[model samples]
Target: MANNQNAELLDKARLLRHDIRDGSFTGYTSGLVPGLVQGNVVILPKVWAEDFLLYCYLNPVSCPLISMSKPGDAMVPALGADIDIRTDIPQYNVFKDGELVEQVTDIEQYWSDDMVSFVLGCSFSFEEALLRAGLSIRNIDLDRNVSMFETNIATAPSAKFFGNTVVTMRPFKPADAIRAIQITTRLPKAHGAPIHIGMPNKIGIEDLAKPEYGDSVPVNDDEIPVFWACGVTPQVAIRNAKPPLCITHVPGKMLVTDKLNDELAVL
Candidate 1:
């Protein structure tokens, strides 16, 4: 099912996952595996999984589920046969009762038999698509983390998981922004389309220099900020819900999986 490019990309995923598992790769995973899908990781106990699943269903843009492992299972067979949720991701954010208590390179000690791991499609998938289409992503080009912010836009609530939407911003020239929009619209599984463009203040973002999550890069005057619903939206919901225990990928760090970007395209 993989082309030569995807095979090369998958090899990168394996190597990157190995590095992450071994505590060598702790930085944000951007532009690592060019074609393989990278995902936002969320882990929760079975008692809390249902509500989160409902939240994901109610808010597809913010929580696009690519694959979810069964309760008590660590391997995500759909994404990769050997994915060990406890260590494959570069970093994990541990939340306790709505607060981020710790961040670690691995969650082996934190893993429990009743835990369920959810892997949501990431913007990295469509970023690759954009790059192939000749669009330059500011974050990647500058080698900095993408800018993400919590917006005033509220996600449709499901159970106790309620919070405002989180968005990732990328700057582009107007014409290139239009083409980027058309390119990304084809990958619904990768958060489909841009939710806002041009003005950050309109979306409750007061400062472009300071992002709520990830590193903020310089935005050129000739370029406009384009925003997309981020997978971090679920993490924000988890924080609001204040579950007893929750684990998520550290903002920009993601789980590299074997799926191809085009494989997730809708049209």
Candidate 2:
């Protein structure tokens, strides 16, 4: 019954991710796998992983860790029974010396014995919840990546990993924004409530139209820009850490997990 239906839905999402890895599908994964939990992937050397884990613990709002694999373990059974960290994600961004060097669908060639993979909760799961509650996510409605920017808000520092938090913005009317906050607050694993609302400049975001990452959605006159701490914030920390090598899922192309969105609800 209910479990079987959930499994079926997750299977479909896994298939979609498989297609993405095989090049049959290469696009933003938002709204594609509804009801399933999607995640931001971070693969780093075991040497750097401990500090990164501490960073997540310190800044849970932006880096809500869902699961982590042992050094060199590619299969994260906790996320999906069949998940292969090397190929399960839709896309991966490779960074060297803190610079993005390339983007690829799979990372089998790059996998190392010292590598460890981490999966963090993504905002997409909560956005799905909002949609189910009859709230409109401007970026989803416009078929774009939610606007993201580097905020002035600093994350709680972990040794060797410290940077300003990055936030994703969605425009909603005042009432809808308040309701959205309430609904999202139930899912802390997926960013929970927004960090700031109504004032973009107050957060150090100069122009909402020019986002640091992802596509920009038009903000209607009646709506205000509401911001949520983003999973991508870790990438900013990675840049600050300047690890010899780091890998992450390309923004908007998350790892679809077997877990249900409802299963992650706090209340």
Candidate 3:
């Protein structure tokens, strides 16, 4: 029975990846494919890969490294079977010299032998745990993208990579917010626990309605906004590092993997 269930989940992942690859599902991956692991992607030339890797090492909460591919290798078997970095994600953000050049559905044309791919754990991996704990996630409940913002918090610098942290926000009542902290604390790879519970302005976020990335969800009067260190922090660093070329998953859109979210939990 367990084997059947695993097979079913793997099938779901493959189907979703298929839709993403073919451009049928070009939207945020927040609430879809529950129970699977999703990732934020970063592709950089070999020359800049080491610095970015070190950056991830310096800031584990915001950029938890999951699986990295060999230079020129587009496949990440550790994350999922036959997972091709070039075409699996829903959307790609092309950056050239610290600026966003374009957004595309795939990176096949830009992919090359000198490039390396890195997959970082995403908070979407933990939303299932929150739901199971009987908590309501406003963004997920509304089928909208989670709100993300650039914060006043500075990340540890490494080589050319240095920037303020980016974070994702979810609204919950004070009591449910505490339970969310307890639930997510077990999944560090998925950015465990809340970094800040309220006061968006305290974190350099002036207005909750206006976000740096992803869609903004409504915050209820009785609820406070809970923030989690986001995987998209690398994109901010990529801008500061000013690499000649870089590729990342579009904010809110992610690379879905066959690995189960349960695998990332600790205790």
Candidate 4:
């Protein structure tokens, strides 16, 4: 019965993803599709892909590569059977000369033969694991996107890609933070473990109430801020690289995949 319930939930989530892809849905997919794997999307010219792939390889904690598509190919068979790169995401950020120029729900008008698509593991996958362990996610409870920041930690450089890492923060009591680290450690694809716990200023963040990206959620007086390596780190690298054209999903929006969260477990 438990398995059946999960299956039903997966079906519902899959349909939601499809609706978003087809232009019927245009909302953040935070807790709507529970138990399904969500991914960060990056599309770049083939000329830039090699360095980007290497960057991901060098910084596995922040950008764990889940799947990549052949240049000009719109489908990622490993993620979902009908996943179309140009239309599968709820929102896209169009960057020109390292700055965001526009936001769109579909990219078919911008698709090109020289483009390559990348799907990176998102922290949402591990949120399912955390919930299974009976830990609460503050952002989910508050109906907001997870708070993310630009950390002082720099990623290992790879050719044109070099920038500071970006991270998402979730507050938990000290005991819950430790358990979150252990639970997330089992899912390396979704950013393994917390990079910093307790001290936000030590990581160069000025205030917990203000975030570099996504919505801010409150932290209780007794809870400590726990930081995880976020997939958004690649966007900072893209900006640094300054490619002629770069595309990525908007901060909270992501590509919902067919792969099960358990399939990504390391142990």
Best candidate according to TM-score: 3
Arrange candidates, best lDDT first: 3, 2, 4, 1
Residue-wise C-alpha lDDT for candidate 2, range 17-105, written one tens digit per residue: 67866778868888877899999999999999999999999999999999999999999898788888898777899999899999998
Better of 3 and 4 by lDDT: 3
The TM-scores, one per candidate, come to 0.97, 0.97, 0.98, 0.97
What digit string (tens of lDDT, one per residue) describes model 1 on residues 1-267?
A: 536666777788888889998998899888888888889989999999998999999988888998988888999889898789999988899999989999999998989889999999889889988998888998999899999999999999988899999999999999999998999899888898999998888989999889999989888989999999999998889989999999999988999988778789986
Compared with the true structure, all predictions reach lDDT values of: 0.90, 0.91, 0.93, 0.90
**How displaced is residue 135 in candidate 3, in Å?**
0.8
What's each prediction's clash count? 0, 0, 0, 0
lDDT string for model 4 (79-191, tens) is 77778889889999999878999999999988999899999999998998999899999999988998999989999999989999899999999999999999999889999
Tens digit of per-residue lDDT, candidate 3, span 42-135: 9999999998999999999999999998999999999987799999999999999989999999999999999999999999999999998889
Worst 10 residues of 4 by lDDT: 27-36
Error of 1 at 165 (Å): 0.5
Q: What is the lDDT of residue 106 in candidate 1?
A: 90
Better of 1 and 3 by lDDT: 3
lDDT of 4: 0.90
The 10-residue segment of model 3 with minimum total lDDT is 28-37
